[model samples]
Target: MIIGKVIGNVWATRKEESLNGMKLMVVRRLDTESGCEQESFVAVDCVGAGIGERVLVTTGSSARMALDNPNKPVDATIVGIIDEVEVRAEG
Candidate 1:
Protein backbone atom coordinates (compact mmCIF):
# COMPACT_ATOMS: atom_id res chain seq x y z
CA MET A 1 0.00 0.00 0.00
CA ILE A 2 1.08 3.57 -0.67
CA ILE A 3 0.14 6.77 1.13
CA GLY A 4 -0.66 9.69 -1.15
CA LYS A 5 -2.66 12.86 -1.60
CA VAL A 6 -5.27 13.30 -4.32
CA ILE A 7 -4.05 16.25 -6.34
CA GLY A 8 -6.35 16.27 -9.32
CA ASN A 9 -8.93 14.41 -11.37
CA VAL A 10 -8.62 12.57 -14.67
CA TRP A 11 -11.30 12.81 -17.30
CA ALA A 12 -11.21 10.22 -20.02
CA THR A 13 -14.20 10.28 -22.30
CA ARG A 14 -12.95 7.34 -24.33
CA LYS A 15 -11.62 4.52 -22.25
CA GLU A 16 -11.95 0.80 -21.82
CA GLU A 17 -15.48 -0.44 -21.13
CA SER A 18 -14.45 -1.94 -17.84
CA LEU A 19 -13.28 1.50 -16.65
CA ASN A 20 -16.34 3.38 -17.73
CA GLY A 21 -17.67 4.05 -14.26
CA MET A 22 -14.42 4.28 -12.40
CA LYS A 23 -13.34 7.65 -10.98
CA LEU A 24 -9.73 8.38 -11.67
CA MET A 25 -7.60 10.82 -9.68
CA VAL A 26 -4.04 12.00 -9.77
CA VAL A 27 -2.38 11.05 -6.52
CA ARG A 28 0.97 12.42 -5.45
CA ARG A 29 3.01 9.96 -3.41
CA LEU A 30 3.89 11.13 0.08
CA ASP A 31 7.03 10.41 1.99
CA THR A 32 5.89 9.24 5.42
CA GLU A 33 8.99 10.38 7.26
CA SER A 34 9.62 13.76 5.65
CA GLY A 35 6.09 14.67 4.62
CA CYS A 36 7.33 15.38 1.12
CA GLU A 37 5.28 14.89 -2.01
CA GLN A 38 6.78 12.76 -4.72
CA GLU A 39 5.77 11.66 -8.20
CA SER A 40 2.11 11.60 -9.09
CA PHE A 41 0.09 9.03 -11.00
CA VAL A 42 -3.47 8.27 -11.95
CA ALA A 43 -5.39 5.80 -9.82
CA VAL A 44 -8.90 4.43 -9.88
CA ASP A 45 -10.90 5.59 -6.90
CA CYS A 46 -12.70 2.83 -5.05
CA VAL A 47 -13.30 4.76 -1.83
CA GLY A 48 -14.76 7.95 -3.30
CA ALA A 49 -11.69 9.99 -2.52
CA GLY A 50 -11.66 13.64 -3.55
CA ILE A 51 -8.98 16.08 -4.54
CA GLY A 52 -6.77 17.35 -1.68
CA GLU A 53 -7.64 14.41 0.53
CA ARG A 54 -5.02 12.01 1.78
CA VAL A 55 -5.58 8.50 0.54
CA LEU A 56 -4.30 4.97 0.73
CA VAL A 57 -3.48 3.32 -2.58
CA THR A 58 -2.98 -0.27 -3.64
CA THR A 59 -0.97 -1.09 -6.75
CA GLY A 60 -0.35 -3.90 -9.23
CA SER A 61 -2.41 -7.07 -8.77
CA SER A 62 -3.62 -5.89 -5.40
CA ALA A 63 -5.10 -2.82 -7.06
CA ARG A 64 -7.34 -5.06 -9.15
CA MET A 65 -8.44 -6.85 -6.01
CA ALA A 66 -9.54 -3.55 -4.52
CA LEU A 67 -11.98 -3.11 -7.35
CA ASP A 68 -13.11 -6.75 -7.03
CA ASN A 69 -12.28 -7.17 -10.71
CA PRO A 70 -9.06 -8.75 -11.86
CA ASN A 71 -9.59 -7.73 -15.48
CA LYS A 72 -10.12 -4.01 -14.97
CA PRO A 73 -6.73 -3.16 -16.57
CA VAL A 74 -5.78 -0.90 -13.70
CA ASP A 75 -2.36 -0.75 -12.15
CA ALA A 76 -3.33 1.46 -9.21
CA THR A 77 -6.43 2.02 -7.10
CA ILE A 78 -7.37 4.23 -4.19
CA VAL A 79 -8.59 1.92 -1.46
CA GLY A 80 -9.09 4.26 1.48
CA ILE A 81 -9.29 7.91 2.52
CA ILE A 82 -6.87 8.58 5.28
CA ASP A 83 -8.05 10.50 8.32
CA GLU A 84 -4.70 10.99 9.92
CA VAL A 85 -1.09 9.86 9.87
CA GLU A 86 1.18 9.72 12.87
CA VAL A 87 4.83 8.85 12.58
CA ARG A 88 6.88 8.30 15.69
CA ALA A 89 10.62 8.47 16.04
CA GLU A 90 12.21 5.12 16.71
CA GLY A 91 14.28 5.00 19.84
Candidate 2:
Protein backbone atom coordinates (compact mmCIF):
# COMPACT_ATOMS: atom_id res chain seq x y z
CA MET A 1 0.00 0.00 0.00
CA ILE A 2 1.14 3.55 -0.82
CA ILE A 3 0.07 6.84 0.75
CA GLY A 4 -0.86 9.46 -1.82
CA LYS A 5 -3.05 12.48 -2.56
CA VAL A 6 -5.64 12.74 -5.28
CA ILE A 7 -4.45 15.60 -7.45
CA GLY A 8 -6.90 15.37 -10.31
CA ASN A 9 -9.52 13.23 -12.08
CA VAL A 10 -9.84 11.22 -15.30
CA TRP A 11 -12.83 10.95 -17.65
CA ALA A 12 -13.47 8.25 -20.19
CA THR A 13 -16.71 7.73 -22.04
CA ARG A 14 -15.77 4.37 -23.41
CA LYS A 15 -13.81 1.67 -21.64
CA GLU A 16 -13.52 -2.05 -21.09
CA GLU A 17 -16.44 -3.99 -19.65
CA SER A 18 -14.64 -4.69 -16.42
CA LEU A 19 -13.87 -0.99 -15.90
CA ASN A 20 -17.17 0.46 -17.02
CA GLY A 21 -18.33 1.88 -13.70
CA MET A 22 -14.96 2.62 -12.15
CA LYS A 23 -13.91 6.21 -11.52
CA LEU A 24 -10.34 7.18 -12.34
CA MET A 25 -8.34 9.78 -10.47
CA VAL A 26 -4.82 11.08 -10.65
CA VAL A 27 -2.72 10.66 -7.52
CA ARG A 28 0.56 12.27 -6.48
CA ARG A 29 2.72 11.29 -3.56
CA LEU A 30 3.44 13.98 -0.99
CA ASP A 31 6.14 14.67 1.56
CA THR A 32 4.78 13.75 5.00
CA GLU A 33 5.10 17.22 6.53
CA SER A 34 5.26 19.79 3.73
CA GLY A 35 2.65 17.96 1.63
CA CYS A 36 4.75 18.72 -1.43
CA GLU A 37 3.23 16.71 -4.28
CA GLN A 38 5.44 14.26 -6.14
CA GLU A 39 5.10 11.81 -9.05
CA SER A 40 1.52 11.53 -10.36
CA PHE A 41 -0.32 8.51 -11.76
CA VAL A 42 -3.86 7.54 -12.68
CA ALA A 43 -5.71 5.05 -10.48
CA VAL A 44 -9.11 3.44 -10.44
CA ASP A 45 -11.35 4.79 -7.68
CA CYS A 46 -12.68 1.83 -5.69
CA VAL A 47 -13.54 3.79 -2.58
CA GLY A 48 -15.05 7.01 -3.99
CA ALA A 49 -12.23 9.44 -3.32
CA GLY A 50 -12.36 13.01 -4.55
CA ILE A 51 -9.74 15.55 -5.63
CA GLY A 52 -7.46 17.13 -3.01
CA GLU A 53 -8.02 14.22 -0.64
CA ARG A 54 -5.32 11.98 0.77
CA VAL A 55 -5.84 8.39 -0.31
CA LEU A 56 -4.37 4.93 0.17
CA VAL A 57 -3.36 3.09 -2.99
CA THR A 58 -2.71 -0.54 -3.79
CA THR A 59 -0.66 -1.59 -6.77
CA GLY A 60 0.03 -4.67 -8.94
CA SER A 61 -1.54 -7.89 -7.69
CA SER A 62 -2.82 -6.28 -4.56
CA ALA A 63 -4.66 -3.74 -6.65
CA ARG A 64 -6.55 -6.43 -8.49
CA MET A 65 -7.43 -8.08 -5.21
CA ALA A 66 -9.18 -4.92 -4.08
CA LEU A 67 -11.63 -5.12 -6.94
CA ASP A 68 -14.58 -7.49 -7.36
CA ASN A 69 -12.71 -9.84 -9.66
CA PRO A 70 -9.01 -10.30 -9.00
CA ASN A 71 -8.36 -11.29 -12.60
CA LYS A 72 -9.46 -7.91 -13.95
CA PRO A 73 -6.86 -5.80 -15.73
CA VAL A 74 -6.00 -3.04 -13.33
CA ASP A 75 -2.65 -1.60 -12.37
CA ALA A 76 -3.61 0.73 -9.52
CA THR A 77 -6.62 1.15 -7.21
CA ILE A 78 -7.66 3.55 -4.49
CA VAL A 79 -8.20 1.52 -1.35
CA GLY A 80 -9.03 4.12 1.29
CA ILE A 81 -9.40 7.80 2.07
CA ILE A 82 -7.06 9.05 4.75
CA ASP A 83 -8.47 11.37 7.37
CA GLU A 84 -5.14 12.24 8.99
CA VAL A 85 -1.49 11.28 8.96
CA GLU A 86 0.98 11.36 11.81
CA VAL A 87 4.63 11.71 10.91
CA ARG A 88 7.48 10.75 13.22
CA ALA A 89 10.96 12.07 12.61
CA GLU A 90 14.01 9.95 13.27
CA GLY A 91 16.85 11.60 15.13
Candidate 3:
Protein backbone atom coordinates (compact mmCIF):
# COMPACT_ATOMS: atom_id res chain seq x y z
CA MET A 1 0.00 0.00 0.00
CA ILE A 2 1.05 3.59 -0.63
CA ILE A 3 0.29 6.54 1.61
CA GLY A 4 -0.57 9.63 -0.35
CA LYS A 5 -2.68 12.78 -0.48
CA VAL A 6 -5.41 13.49 -3.01
CA ILE A 7 -4.37 16.51 -5.04
CA GLY A 8 -7.12 16.66 -7.65
CA ASN A 9 -9.88 14.82 -9.52
CA VAL A 10 -10.45 13.52 -13.03
CA TRP A 11 -13.56 13.47 -15.18
CA ALA A 12 -14.20 11.53 -18.33
CA THR A 13 -17.58 11.25 -19.98
CA ARG A 14 -16.39 8.55 -22.34
CA LYS A 15 -14.05 5.96 -20.88
CA GLU A 16 -13.19 2.31 -21.12
CA GLU A 17 -16.18 0.03 -20.67
CA SER A 18 -14.61 -1.52 -17.60
CA LEU A 19 -14.11 1.90 -15.99
CA ASN A 20 -17.63 3.17 -16.35
CA GLY A 21 -18.44 3.87 -12.71
CA MET A 22 -15.11 4.62 -11.08
CA LYS A 23 -14.03 7.90 -9.46
CA LEU A 24 -10.55 9.04 -10.41
CA MET A 25 -8.15 11.16 -8.39
CA VAL A 26 -4.63 12.52 -8.67
CA VAL A 27 -2.48 11.29 -5.78
CA ARG A 28 1.00 12.36 -4.75
CA ARG A 29 2.95 9.87 -2.66
CA LEU A 30 4.34 11.16 0.65
CA ASP A 31 7.21 10.38 3.00
CA THR A 32 6.65 8.69 6.34
CA GLU A 33 6.89 11.72 8.65
CA SER A 34 7.88 14.87 6.75
CA GLY A 35 5.33 14.19 4.02
CA CYS A 36 7.98 14.80 1.38
CA GLU A 37 7.18 14.27 -2.25
CA GLN A 38 7.79 10.91 -3.82
CA GLU A 39 5.68 10.46 -6.95
CA SER A 40 2.29 11.21 -8.41
CA PHE A 41 -0.17 9.00 -10.21
CA VAL A 42 -3.83 8.75 -11.07
CA ALA A 43 -5.84 6.28 -9.05
CA VAL A 44 -9.38 4.99 -8.77
CA ASP A 45 -11.10 6.11 -5.57
CA CYS A 46 -12.85 3.12 -4.09
CA VAL A 47 -13.19 4.73 -0.64
CA GLY A 48 -14.71 8.01 -1.81
CA ALA A 49 -11.66 10.11 -0.95
CA GLY A 50 -11.78 13.81 -1.70
CA ILE A 51 -9.14 16.39 -2.49
CA GLY A 52 -6.70 17.11 0.37
CA GLU A 53 -7.60 13.87 2.10
CA ARG A 54 -4.79 11.51 3.10
CA VAL A 55 -5.46 8.16 1.51
CA LEU A 56 -4.13 4.64 1.37
CA VAL A 57 -3.51 3.49 -2.22
CA THR A 58 -3.03 -0.01 -3.46
CA THR A 59 -1.24 -0.57 -6.73
CA GLY A 60 -0.74 -3.30 -9.33
CA SER A 61 -2.51 -6.64 -9.11
CA SER A 62 -3.20 -6.06 -5.41
CA ALA A 63 -5.36 -3.11 -6.35
CA ARG A 64 -7.40 -5.17 -8.75
CA MET A 65 -7.73 -7.81 -6.10
CA ALA A 66 -8.90 -5.30 -3.51
CA LEU A 67 -11.88 -4.38 -5.66
CA ASP A 68 -12.85 -8.06 -5.81
CA ASN A 69 -14.10 -7.36 -9.32
CA PRO A 70 -11.67 -8.62 -11.91
CA ASN A 71 -13.22 -6.60 -14.71
CA LYS A 72 -12.88 -3.14 -13.06
CA PRO A 73 -9.90 -2.18 -15.29
CA VAL A 74 -8.06 -0.32 -12.56
CA ASP A 75 -4.31 -0.28 -12.02
CA ALA A 76 -4.45 1.56 -8.73
CA THR A 77 -7.23 1.98 -6.18
CA ILE A 78 -7.60 4.01 -2.99
CA VAL A 79 -8.25 1.46 -0.28
CA GLY A 80 -8.51 3.58 2.84
CA ILE A 81 -8.48 7.11 4.29
CA ILE A 82 -5.61 7.45 6.75
CA ASP A 83 -6.24 9.38 9.95
CA GLU A 84 -2.67 9.10 11.24
CA VAL A 85 0.60 7.25 10.93
CA GLU A 86 2.90 5.97 13.64
CA VAL A 87 6.47 5.11 12.84
CA ARG A 88 9.51 4.19 14.92
CA ALA A 89 12.91 5.12 13.60
CA GLU A 90 16.09 3.60 15.01
CA GLY A 91 19.44 5.07 14.31
Best by lDDT: 1
Local accuracy of candidate 3 as per-residue lDDT tens digits, 1-91? 8899999988999889778777889999999788898889999998889899999999997888777586677889999999889886762
The residue pairs found clashing in candidate 1 are none
- Cα lDDT tens digits for candidate 2, 1-91: 7889998888888787888878889999877788877888989999989988999999988899888888878999999999888887772
Using all chains and alpha carbons, the TM-scores for the candidates as numbered come to 0.93, 0.87, 0.89
lDDT of 1 by residue, 56-91 (tens): 999998899987678879999999999888887872
Better of 2 and 3 by lDDT: 3
Model 1, TM vs. native: 0.93
TM-score winner? 1
Model 1 stretches astray by more than 4 angstroms: none
Candidate 2 clashes between residue pairs 3 or more apart in a chain or in different chains: none
Q: Which stretches of candidate 2 lie over 4 Å from their true place?
A: none
lDDT of 1 at 31: 96
Query: Of models 1 and 3, which has the larger lDDT?
Result: 1
